[model samples]
Target: MKRRKVPLRMCISCKEMKPKKELLRIVKNSEGKINIDLNGKLPGRGAYICHNPQCLEKAIKHKLFERIFQQKVDKEIYVRLTDILTENDEDI
Candidate 1:
């Protein structure tokens, strides 16, 4: 018997391919709302980023998140994104 392969996703910030379950997924729903998808089951355009503050900063500074979503990100949302990154770091 063969083991199943794990799905891999590329991080928008670091541009590194990592296991999907290890990275966090940020998604923009049909209504153009952006939020973190903990379950990775949200239906919409999504972007991947490592759970690292440095990557979050890079992605925000370079507007990579906006590029992935094809829309300007809300300032408040970016703040929340950073906060979330910090919080995730605390968990580790």
Candidate 2:
């Protein structure tokens, strides 16, 4: 039997390529809704980020979401991302 290949995605913060399952996804939907995508199956444009809080901060500090999505990110979205990060940390 042959093993399947794993998909990879690049983190917008640290810019490292990692397995897709390990990265958190953020999506901009067609209706202009932006949110954290835990399932990684949402439609529209998507960007990847590491679960690490530092990477989240760097992305926020540099306005990376704006650059990639070409729209302003809501403060609430950042808050939600931070909350998710904390939850992820607690799991470890």
Candidate 3:
């Protein structure tokens, strides 16, 4: 039997590749609304971020999401992502 291939995604903040299941997905839809896709099933342009505080900070510092989305990303979005990262960390 062959082993199933793991899907890999790059963390927008750190620019590092990691398994898709290990990262959070943020989506930009047709209406340009951005959302945090917890289940990885949202329909849109999705970007991944690892569960690391440092990565979130770096992305915020350099406005990484803004570059990818081609729009000004709100600070609240980063804050929310930070909260999610911290929550996930606590779970482990």
Best by TM-score: 2
Model 3 pairs whose backbones collide: none
> What is the Cα-based TM-score of model 1?
0.89
Order of the predicted models by lDDT, top scorer first: 2, 1, 3
Off by over 4 Å in 3: none
- Per-residue accuracy of model 3 over 1-92 as CA lDDT, tens digit each: 99999999999988889999999899999999889899999999998989988888888898888889999887778879999998888888
Listed in order, each prediction's TM-score against the native is: 0.89, 0.94, 0.92
Judged by lDDT against the true structure, how good is candidate 2?
Answer: 0.94
**Residue-wise lDDT of candidate 2 within 1-92, one digit each (tens)?**
99998999999999999999889999999999898899988998999999889999999999999899999999999999999997898898
- Roughly what TM-score does model 3 have, to 2 decimal places? 0.92
RMSD of each: 1.3, 1.0, 1.1
Top candidate (lDDT): 2
lDDT of each: 0.90, 0.94, 0.89
Q: How much RMSD separates candidate 2 from the native structure?
A: 1.0
